[model samples]
Target: MLISKTVKINQTDNRVESVSCGECKGNKNHKILVSAEMAQDEDSCFDYQVIQCLGCNRISFRHALYEYTQYQATSEKIYPDPKQRLPIEGINLLKPYIQSIYKETLKTINNNQVILFGTGIRTILEAITQEQKTPGIDLNEKINNLVKQGLVTQKDVGALHDLRRIGNEATHSITPSSPKEIKVAMDVIEHLLQRIYILPHNVKENLSSPLKNKPNTK
Candidate 1:
């Protein structure tokens, strides 16, 4: 059970969902390497710990200050996890530099920094348009340029425009984005990444190999 959204530990249970591993690009189970607790009252306490990520053999420290009675907690990332996330060589979209930027966007969202998350998603879109070689004075023009250059279709124009609109809102601070909007933006970007990056890379690999997706005719 990975808690993708929640950051606080369940005070009474002495456990929390493992944080995302930048190296693995997914959540991995963790163990309390060391812990200390202080009781503020008979019914409340705070716990702090150094936890180890089991997946990539990396260590990072985070401490949860929790009050069990009121169910209040605040966390601090005492030591920044210095490990750079390994690129997904399996997908071309995981180019080291670009992938790092995208991962940071994910990290912001995971940490509940809602505004930055919108801006981050917007940056990803800019990266995609750049890679496609669609140049423009601004993102809207760049996206329109993509459609003009035949890199994108009319079918996809709406989604791309919607993503741009969200970014524009964030940049202008028109309104704060809801969690639902962020979730949808994440979905849209991942879909774009998969289609533009992963699919083409996989297609090339398949073409280079004898294996092909053919209809079975036995």
Candidate 2:
């Protein structure tokens, strides 16, 4: 049996905590709006709080567990997780499906979905190859095709292969990538997307007109 009590905190309560806000995309001060406690037994209890970010006014739920028998330590988790990486600049320039996959891949890593993270990374790479119409039967050959098409150089193929290996390990052997490894992989992907999609779009939008008007000397 569990006993619980809900408390409605007033605006004047002034209880604030530093937490990551999805809208703000970083840690900010959040004021507690409502709080509740449930006691599973004499030795353990759970705390739930509704918090609103002071900066962005974004709301989030925080849950914590306390055990008196375990030296009064507390374990806390935030609902909906927190944003880990912001969308890459000019992400809208990519194909719609690729943009969606890229955003979801970021979320997967942010939520600590290790297996999904690897798979997502792989999916992003494959989507790029498909969008570019690289001719290959499999991902390995497709990645190499990217080089022949002048999409990526020999140096970049090595990094793409590393990402492919990580994905394979996760999908086939159930291996989990570390956070640092995930971060590097994401960086590489972002760079590739920027070079192939965003940068070209930017150049065309910003530089094409200027170059067109330059007086030709030859």
Model 1 — TM-score against the truth? 0.55
Which residue pairs show backbone clashes in model 2? none
CA-lDDT, candidates in order:
0.68, 0.84
Model 1 lDDT tens row, 100-218: 66788778766777777777888888888777778899998898887787767888888888888887887897555788887788877777777777878888876655545655677
Residues 1-218 of candidate 2: C-alpha lDDT, one tens digit per residue: 54455442442265777777877888888887887766667777776788899998877888867685763227878876765566888998899999999999998887888888888899999999999999999999999999999999999999999999988988999999998999899999999999999998898877787755878988
Task: Go through the candidates in order and give the clash count of each.
Answer: 0, 0
lDDT of 2 at 208: 85
- My TM-score estimates for the predictions, one after another, are 0.55, 0.63
**What is candidate 2's TM-score against the reference?**
0.63
